[model samples]
Target: MAQQLGGRARSLQEGPGEYRLDNGQHILIGAYTESLGLMRKLGVNLEQSLLRQPLRLRYPDHEGLSLPPGPPLLSFVRGILSYKTWHLSARLQLLARATVWLLQGFRCKPELSVAQLCAGLPSIVRQELMDPLCVAALNTPSSQASAEVFLRVLHDALFSGRGSADLLLPRRDLSELLAEPAQQWLRVRGTQIFLGTRVHTLKQAADAWHLEISGAPQGETQCFDQVVLACTSLQAAKLAEPWAPAWAQAAQALHFEPIVTVYLRAPGSALPAAMVALNEGPDAPAQFAFDLGALGHAPGLFAFVISGASDWVAQGLKETGAATLQQALQAFNWRCSPEVYRVLAEKRATFACTPGLQRPGIQVARGLWAAGDYIAGPYPATLEGAVRAGKNAALACLQV
Candidate 1:
């Protein structure tokens, strides 16, 4: 690896380090080169297809060579019909209702451009699967995901094979499935990731930016070849304060949403599966639960997920997660209680969804570049958005 990258690999530490990741579990260091090999074997074509053809579907009448027009449309219609069934899990049902409301409001007032889009788009592509619950989870709403962003995601999901692969194999442990891949990718690509070391502040010098981190007294600074502020909006604002105060002000205005998940260690006898989505009945704090054991965990635990959870922040975790578990147990007869395990709350998990929220460019101030789920992108605060932002920031740095 060092020979391939030449002297560029000199500064980076050889091999990887073992660390205790979240939940106090020790993660052994290994070259997940095998995973990449498996991904290649799977023939998933995991690269961003939209990046290949940015303007392929931008025009209203433009139909590409990918899918047969009729089949794609039929698939969409089938999807719509399937969603209409009342048996959908409560999570999807709430999502369906929210989507209808949003679309109705949009259709009724009908802004000129939005209306034009609705009219111009092919009939097959008209009925979008706009899930507001998922959208808000990422930092923005489905309505505000932006036409460009929505189109890109749609093209990837429908035309390219990558989207279907992702949808087919949705993982139960998000932090492991999502972040771990990224960690490995960066390591393989010769980029260093120093986890557990939280960055506290940044200083810009004559030619490079200095990063100050936690656990260091006075201030220990390291100069990087190029700096990417791949963090939340609030962190970016604080980092930019000393150098570009105006940029900081703009970044601070961006708001974030909270995400919480409850892990229930129910006996295998309690439920046959680790995951389920409910679509009906009273408002439950959670919309979905994953049988962690089925997805490579202890057989007794089920992970319940809640996103865009602003209303439940002030409520005590014991109360919130317990109520959610009670609802699920009542419906499925899964004898599990919150008291059996743990509840994890990520308060500032993502940015909030609002129209015209301040999303600064990758090149906010000179050499400094912004990344993370927050940077201005079509879809608010999602992992995809973060990846796009990182790529954009990298490109910005390269251009400099």
Candidate 2:
């Protein structure tokens, strides 16, 4: 309503030359019902745009946990038990810990970090599964990530129902999935579509909300009965400072985590799977790699994603790209040496999903509302969270 994108992530980006690559390399799970429903409503072809696959954490050696197709609970148990690489004790220990979490309704203390909650688990399970999972789901390390949110993600992905954990790899660019279709849908509904517009200021008048936007005719102030601040948190904070200082401060107080995506172009190469989980160490900079070739988007292209990349960000992008190139060389079998095609870093990719994190709520004032993935919610800062927040905010605005 405000801009072309209501609550889309900044991960989708354009690269130099003719190749249109995703800068942040975002992945959506089957549990993201809100986003998926929105896409379907926009008349986008989900089957053609996404490559759905069962949940698998396979490595180059094909040694990792994988869920089979069946009843959700049975599939999860079978997957965990059949993972032969983990010791029998390690597997049993994981099951026991998971049972405890499930019995407790997948809820935990808000102050407990993921590492603290899984402290007694076997080291192998932590290294191979929990650590990467925490980073991927929360975009934060286990020691700093929130246990409550981690459990929520696990519940939805592993235990909610069948296909809930399936990874929806984008076969097309994000523009096709969200922005383009959404814009067309809005335009079809008689909504005025304005590109390259900025809301310079916002103020509450006696009877209506006033917005000083760039695209307004003759520099007029646009008046509306209700206003939804669907822009970035920083911009929302600045606009709401005059109306709601406390909410503005809360929005400004939230910290952020960065994500780095390194795209590699290898001539005539492919990975064993569409997506593979990698081990991250002091020298290794990537946690997961996606074979764009396998996803049917590109022929010999790959994307290495480094979530919770605070340390990697400090070392500089060139060093990070070089280290990732070396890591890829050792981790996978390539037809030719992979060269770094482009390196993209999102400094404020997500709000730090840490323990006891306080986020701003959607309600800013009586006649105004806010929406973003960073708004207070059960889910982490993700595409699903953004969609749900925007829908709720719009519904609330309509009711008022």
Candidate 3:
């Protein structure tokens, strides 16, 4: 894969048939905004997948349970605006309804009436094109996730007007996706990213702030006018103690929710798309799906994405993750043929999506600030939320 940077072509395929990530697979169309736009402009490749198989969904009329006709931009907005804050139960029910309506509209554009749009779908996929790419990107189930967050993401996707189609897929390894790209970006920017050098203690000097890293004996210190604590809420609290004691204490008080991704490679079985979301019942563990085989030419490879998975975070991996994938495969009526796979446990994927949860100000003290998916933002802990938070924190630091 060749990536174009500064009008120059760069080889993305360093040494590979194709690289895969454990948490999920990322289809990098281009650079962030530019690639997204270009992919959308060029047209979506959704037609060349298992999603087009016209299979019956769980609930046809119940909403997101089935595919929508067109993009659910307006209905998504309406559902989000009408929903109460942090009400997962109520919110998902409405969003599912919106998903059905949107699918119906996308399929044939049957009617413009909101009432018609409100009709329930009979199966999982009511139409031809059931691309839940947006839902996957936000990491919130289209059925239960906040519409406001979806709208924000949708706006960003359509705003740039580029023809890029970005899909979020789960790979067998986590480090394959996050660590490498981050390392590359850091390398290009000449920033130090100490992977094993964990900061254990932090204190502010008269001028520069001192940090006690895990490896170094005496602890090396670095100086800067500002520091961006981009770690989790709990970790950020530790880093901000000296600069903002009270603020750090309050930051530590912020609660978090975990997410678990289970990867499964069914050697002979095939999945619908590069990614799909499973509509599980109340007690079920697994949630989403990613097709590794869809990326170029990998085969019988798939992943299960389990979000809001606090219950099974620390359980036996082969037992919980593998079993869940087996059950999920049963849902699709596919054989539970296990191959090479792994479970990615993100202890703090996001914080609770409550009302005032979005009100945590980014400005920790004066020179100190914070940025992450958990911090105050438009929605829950997601890529878009993280990006927005980072941009906002950078601006806050620059303004000072």
RMSD of each: 11.1, 2.0, 10.2
Q: C-alpha displacement of 356 in model 2, angstroms?
A: 1.1
- Residue-wise C-alpha lDDT for candidate 2, range 133-163, written one tens digit per residue: 8999999999999999999888888765778
Evaluated against the true structure, the overall lDDT of model 2 is: 0.87
Q: Which stretches of candidate 1 lie over 4 Å from their true place?
A: 1-72, 81-193, 214-219, 270-275, 280-283, 335-339
**Alpha-carbon runs more than 4 Å astray in model 3:** 1-20, 24-179, 216-219, 282-284, 314-318, 333-336
lDDT of 3 at 372: 73
Candidate 2 runs further than 4 Å off = 1-17, 215-220
Query: 2 or 3, which is superior by TM-score?
Result: 2
Per-model clash counts, in order, read 10, 0, 44
Question: What is the per-residue lDDT of model 3 for residues 117-231, given as tens digits with 9 covering 90 to 100?
Answer: 3235333222211224323444434443444444444444323232222233322233323344445666788875554456676666675556666654445665567777776
Q: Using TM-score as the measure, name the better of candidate 1 and candidate 3.
A: 1
lDDT of each: 0.49, 0.87, 0.49
Task: Itemize residue pairs with steric clashes in candidate 1.
Answer: 89-278, 89-279, 90-278, 90-279, 90-280, 91-278, 138-381, 274-290, 274-291, 275-291
| Residue 400 of model 2, lDDT score | 76
